[model samples]
Target chain A: MSDRTDPPGRRSTGKLIVSYTIVGVPLLYGLVATAIKASQLFT
Target chain B: MGVTQLLDRERTVAPPGYNRWLIPPAALAIHLSIGQVYAFSVFKNPLVERFGSSETAVAVVFSLAIAVLGLSAAFLGPWMERNGPRKAMVLSAVCFSGGFLVSALGVAAGQLWVVYLGYGLLGGIGLGIGYISPVSTLIKWFPDRPGLSTGLAIMGFGGGAFIASAVSDRLLRTLAPEPTAAIAPAFVVLGLAYLLLMTYGAWLVKVPPPGYAPGGYDPAEDETGVEARDITADQAIRTHQFWLVWVVLFTNVTAGIGILEQASPMIQDFFDQVDASAAAGYVGLLSIANMLGRFVWSSSSDYVGRRPVYAMYLGVGAVAVLTVILIGASSLAVFVLGTGLLISFYGGGFATVPAYLKDLFGSHQVGAIHGRLLTAWSAAGVAGPLIINILTESQRRGGAEGAAAYRPSLFVVVAMLAIGFVANLFVRPLAEGASDEDIGRRHRAEPAGSPG
Candidate 1:
């Protein structure tokens, strides 16, 4: 759904990256932590 | 005037050429913060110790939060839709964070009632408001891919608990000499952190400009297996289709909780070799499955269609539960995989429903309709766990061992799924005559002046 070809004011790639980062970093951390904990199911 | 004017729907409309992709993350921020309610169990033992109360008494706090979440969501859904996501989200942030601060004071003062009023009532309102705040807006923005867009945001609700569980556990450990002593401070820290994060969501979110559709998108080509009809929340509830959908959600959730409510103990009881830590891992794995499934299954619904996808969740999900009973009891792999699949469907059921409602009732009042429908969840939350607990305790009292103790409840879960499947079959499109004009006339008659 990228509007890359849209006029100058339409593109917000920088803001897009920042927005994803705000929620993504914490989500990644939680996923890794949960994955580590879940590894105990095998061991 | 300043803040009020800024938060108005007209003020927050997307500027020309604004990318819609940014909206999901904003929705995600609010969902993730409020999803912390799922992790309230982490504080159970600490609170029990602090208040010198019974486990049931401490447990009441979480129950109250969830019950309130459903009730408030059902009642305030129209208000959120009227006010727009930005203002609703800001209100959610304040009540949610304010809940923590109030609860912290309650903890310090050794008053359990204060904590209930803070976390349960106030925070529950936040959860309810935040949960539905972005849904209708997301549906509007991504009309071509309503399922995928709503799924992206709702997925945060499932994943939020994992983040909260780990973060809250760590905070409890390091914040004070004893975890119980740290409860108040942890609430403060979490409250502040959530406020900052949720505010970012409120700031970033914008409603799509009227008549805006993505380039290359056309409504005539829509293919979700149902013709669209704009039905207000009031009128939507009066349809048989609405209650059928409600039953679909209620039964799906009730069945899933049959496994989740006692994941740790159930696994250990199924296998002699499994310990608390291994069971803990199993629970974590289920959380991952639940989180991922919300995104995967709901996005797939955009293609597979909402009705058929729900059929799979209910129909195939029933088979999974039965498989768990027949062979899963003897095999850990079967048990884990079966229950994990069930839980994924459970989460998927939640994430997919908004799009499902949009398909059935149209986007105009989907959020409010969705809000009213969540009362089913509140009802199921109480019924599911209560039924499982009672059945299992009875089995244990009867001297049943290992998997035998849970066998009866598993059968009940399968039955619940079967019921949901039947309900799914009954969910046909809104009858051909419920035209937009007819619904609009009814809405205009109502005195509330609530926007759809």
Candidate 2:
């Protein structure tokens, strides 16, 4: 099921983005760097 | 009352329109952060130089952390279950990130024991709690697809090393101009960062209300043939199946870790034609494979079943190790492929074990049982490196050449895998009424709805 607004146990889009940014920023940073290192080693 | 009330699992039932997809990302937020524990070695050299301690002394920190991880996961299993995943995750977030903050101070002051207390002791408990908290909740939310759901989060743990190794290196280089003095600030920053990430996970995590399965999934059709009885943590340890799975995990980990802990050096030692850079590349490739196998093999187990999947891990793993031993490093491709496949199986063993637990024991306190099983990992962590290092050293002393140096050690791993294979064969269903006795005991012992 999906909800638009004011749902129980479901986070709002703004809240979701805040949570994602907190976790995603570091993970993305690391993944991008890993890609760079992989390229350097393979190429 | 507000944050606590929001965090209370009883108060957090999903809305009629709650989307289950949001859960996996919440899990990943914690797993990926703690998985950075595997990359703790990135700081090994810097730590050694900074503290004027031997590499062995620095290594003790990692070993101690792993030991604590197993011990706490096992001992704290019941408490974690009673409190719920949300509370468990919050505690993990605090201890793990706080360990870094404390260890940072230890580094700045050069008090090595305090560093051990911070990262090794406190951080290890964080690893244990962070690991088991999401497991039961994922099974509850995705009852029809436990393997696939758990695999997604576990893969995040495996991938954490890639993120941590890369990010920590960049962070250290930029932040620490006085390289030795850099560890403190780096620890502070990283700790704060992980706290934020894991707190988001804690904030987001919610246990599905009892009996809430996904729509269109028949609880009747979902029968795994394993009886749906509630086996408490205490009863699980008393069962033959638990010990057998423990041996299976220990051997699988020992064999795979024997290769992983020595991947870089073993590659160079085996192939004189391979340079240092090439060996590093090989090690990197194994890390990727290790991460991939966590997702692929574990997800596949849902279709093939946990037993057959594990049989493949143990049986095929033995063959791969044997291939390296017999063939030596004559063909670079074979060496790489063989070792890489073994690494995949190693990761697969980790990803598949929880689903196996769910099969043998019912979902009731499965998280607690899972925590107990991870003790095998701590044992294997020590055993793997010790076995590899000792055998290789003795071989070198006996005047073994290049690839010949690793042959004895690799064969030893094959023998270990063979034992694991035999143990997997002995894994049958738990005896009848074992769950009943435990459940009855729990009912008499505690108030309704309290965790086992």
TM-score of each: 0.95, 0.91
C-alpha local distance difference test of each model: 0.89, 0.82
Kindly report which residue stretches of model 2 are placed more than 4 angstroms away from their true locations once superposed.
A1-32, A35-43, B2-6, B431-435, B438-452
Model 1: per-residue Cα lDDT at residue B41: 92
| Span of 10 residues, lowest total lDDT, candidate 1 chain B | B443-452
Q: Lowest summed lDDT over 10 consecutive residues: which window, candidate 2 chain B?
A: B443-452
| Candidate 1: true contacts recovered, fraction | 0.54
The numbered model that scores best in TM-score is 1
Local lDDT at B194 for model 2? 91
Error of 2 at B76 (Å): 1.1
Candidate 1 Cα errors over 4 Å, as ranges: A1-11, B224-229, B436-452
Tell me the interface RMSD of every candidate, in Å: 3.3, 4.4
Per-residue lDDT tens digits for candidate 2, residues B1-452, read 67655566676566555556667888899899899998898899899999999999999999888888889898888888887888889889999999999999899889999999999999999999999989988877776678888887888897888888987787779896866777889899889989988898887887775667676766656555443677788877766677888999999999999899898888888877667776667777888778889889999999998889999999999998888887857777788889889999999899888889988887788889999999898889889999999989999999997888888888889999999998888888654444467545544565532322
State in Å the error of residue B122, model 2. 1.4
Please give the RMSD to the true structure for each candidate, in Å: 4.0, 4.9
Candidate 1, residue B213: the lDDT equals: 70
